[model samples]
Target: EESGSDSSQKQQSSQKSDSKGGSKGEGESENHEYISDAKKVMIEPIEAAQLDINHVVFLDPGKISITCPKDIGEHRSFIYDLETRQVVKLPDNTTVLKKLDNDDLFVMTKENTEYAILDGSSYTVKKAIMRPANVDNSLDISPDGKSIAYVTDEGLFVSDLDFQNPTRIVAAKREGKVFDMELPRFPKWFDANRIGYKVVGFKGVLYCGVVTRDGTVSKTYMEAQDATLYPLVNGDYLFRNDSGKGIGIIDANTGQKKFITESLLDKEGFAFDKNGKWVSYYMTNKEVTEENKWTGRFEVKGISSESKIMEFETEKPNAKPVENAVASPDGKFLLFTDMDMTGRRVLYKLEINAEQSQQSQKK
Candidate 1:
């Protein structure tokens, strides 16, 4: 909870390149506020959590909902209010489909079989959304929250929030485009009128496709031999960054690649700020062997200018490496997921210096 210099586990170094990324001088941190301290959130006390937290959705700046995978102690989701330090179960024992920030409406699901739209403020069921019987991670609500898009055994369909008037958008029988329940890249609503999906073809090839409300796929992004496409919030994507080596943003609309950093090794923890201005990922120079595979240098860089904002290496002896990172909504703090020796995932919040964060917020 204390945010100050924790030099013991945080490494701030001089001008050098560890791998192919993060070229910063030793004095670089004097101008920028790097990581300070980290403390585990008090969520472990809740026994149902089973010492694991994942799939976090920000209900607002003050509240968040988290859910662990099915393999956890019990399949359930809980909402944690940061200000009050209270946890409550979500209605329908559902998983949040989208972040409910200020917006009063969002979709959540129960065991992937049923869907419901709820009012964020009251947490009351607003509409009965539909889900494909056999699908997981199959539904995405439109940006406007008026429509829901989902994938089924037959095809992809769009319907009103009430689960009625479903219009088939893509037919698997005719287009050979099917949504894979096993993959994390579920159906996504990229804009007000379109849903994005990825089609895995023969030999592990991928096609990043965007279908408009009228079901048109033109000039889709066909992937290179081994590249996996990750969708960006704006329908652009992490086209070249999937390999954990070259990190970048590819404009699927124009096919322009914006290289953020090259030679990063931690694909497990790649993230962009809410505005897509800053990027964070892990990098390493030494060979990843059994002994030191879980330690490396983490960096945050400006996307367009390719400038290094800050870098630090985390130290966790005999524990797992940081697997995920999220920038706070105000661009002032970073939230990370680390682990203790017992393999319990812990959430840590690190804040930048007040001056640096205040300036960022003004931007």
Candidate 2:
């Protein structure tokens, strides 16, 4: 009788253990499980009081432009001077400049008019006589405010403040080639004298290239899957798809490549801080349920190698978060943007604890 009683007790114990294990697995579906132990921080939506109420920031807010009336040509764009609160409209059929530098902007119009180097704040024509007039051109200013790189005639050109002779960096493709190569997209400034850009993508491949002030080209083996380009920050660059797969990093100067994270395999998009310390992207999973609220996750980090640091699952349901986020040059404040109910983008600022970052490094 004693032996039979012991066997029955053991069986009950085993059954209860199995039941507890099953219950724990079921609970895991709802909560976030950190794949690795990482430090966590909670992010709250801080309010952003507008500095300029008259201008609504557009799809690309890196260069803020004043909103124009409906009748204006669709190609025309505006830039607002943050200091003077003046809005300057470039020539008709001209676009607002991207990649702004201190107090100046570079614009290219339908005819390649040379008037790109202009007062960003006052919108006054600073240099029109030097502009070319017949090619679709795009230009960017180096971060140090010393030089400008503009594209025209299917080639990349660099000029100085005086708008002297423009040097052609990349030759236009041989005219007779059947491929009908397109001129490279606007070059992005990695430093005062270096630029990064990609050739047009074709057949599921994008040729990523980097150029310097002296006109040297270095190519990366990696091919971007889509036409959308990633932003450059600090010394690194981040690229992702809409479903968030194929996210990787490249040396901003040398084009060295490394894979950091892989999530949301079908589509992905990303944003980075000016110093390139923080990067955020979206993820999607078809199997997720309605109660989970969002299909994406946002992560921030101090370095590219420390891939998993601060992660927050989406709190709002079916909301589109800003992927064009920017950091103040000092990295003290982070600006978040998104479209409001009317489908217009709004910018918000968040203050970061600079002291906490310093303390964490000491640990």
Candidate 3:
């Protein structure tokens, strides 16, 4: 009886071990499947040796316009045809500002005092208008191409395409109780009848709001202490906080604000995809040394907090850090200006591909 009991005990122990091993194997298989599904996409770099392009604007899927600086302190803008890989120069001394929704180009003189609407195909000036006095280069043409919105010392103004019958959308003021002084900057068109702008108030408080073409300001949509307010095609606004903590979006109709992230570092560059689904921002990794000193690695995170799609390490020796990284309208490419290891400023285009669709969760 003792010998039979020993055999049974040994068999039971063996069976338990086999069961545990099978469970472990299944766990590892699940882990491998998850990792493979969540793998990041790669970024492919494109080199441009023939053209000295600085700024780029996508005219369409197959064509892009670039602004190259001339030796005379003016810009020579041109259209680059991707299929043919050819660069065709536009008008000289003209800096392309905003590409209107109608596919026309809004261009300004290097002096910023003269503005014109140019035909994209012919590269000819369709309408020329003299900018107002004391007005800076901050301007936005309406979507329909019939009006222009700009900022002046007196206030934010909108005028007809011909510069006739200019109307003040908002007036600058000085208030001792709330703010010492308040002025508008960088007026943009929200729609056909509304304009958006950033208001700099006392103590460097920034506010963003939308006002009607007839000067009716929306009280519910004003955001204070915001850095920059970008009008989106979906009628929403994307803004960064004054502390630069993170970026968020404000719904145009609902007036609800949702933050995307809060781990942003000061002066770190960020850009949103055209559809506002994905954001690419710079992040730094710090290392502590034996001497109690800290070192940082400049990296780029092409994701939000909840999901990560791709990451880039820009910590190479002698490679200047990137700035002003922007996503293409189609969200397929990222463009940025950076200095190479040779210390020459160059524009780079990065192709973005992800395994899964990038969709942001609305909280």
Among the numbered candidates, top TM-score falls to: 3
TM-score of each candidate structure, all chains considered together: 0.69, 0.56, 0.72
Assess candidate 2 and give its lDDT.
0.47
Query: lDDT for model 1, on a 0 to 1 scale?
Result: 0.56
- lDDT, ranked from best to worst: 3, 1, 2
Candidate 2 lands at a TM-score of: 0.56
Tens digits of per-residue lDDT for model 2 on 1-363? 114543343233332234234432310111112111111111111112122212233213333543322343344355543324344555554544444546555554433444455575566666553544543445666664566677765577777754457777766564655465645665777676667665652333346556677787555435454423455555566655433454666665565656555554233224445555555455545454445424545544444543343333444455554433545455554444444433434444433443232111100
lDDT of 3 by residue, 245-291 (tens): 56677777777777765545444446666555566654432332333
In model 3, the runs with Cα more than 4 Å from the true position are 1-51, 175-179, 217-224, 233-235, 253-256, 265-269, 284-305, 316-318, 354-363
Per-residue CA lDDT of candidate 1, range 186-246, in tens?
A: 4677667767665544434355566786676534555422344555555566644444556
RMSD of each: 9.1, 13.2, 13.0
Look at candidate 1 and tell me the lDDT of residue 20: 16
lDDT of the candidates, in the order given: 0.56, 0.47, 0.59
Clashing pairs in 3: none
CA deviation > 4 Å runs, candidate 2? 1-102, 105-123, 129-134, 142-148, 152-154, 159-164, 172-183, 216-236, 239-244, 252-255, 264-269, 286-294, 305-318, 341-344, 352-363
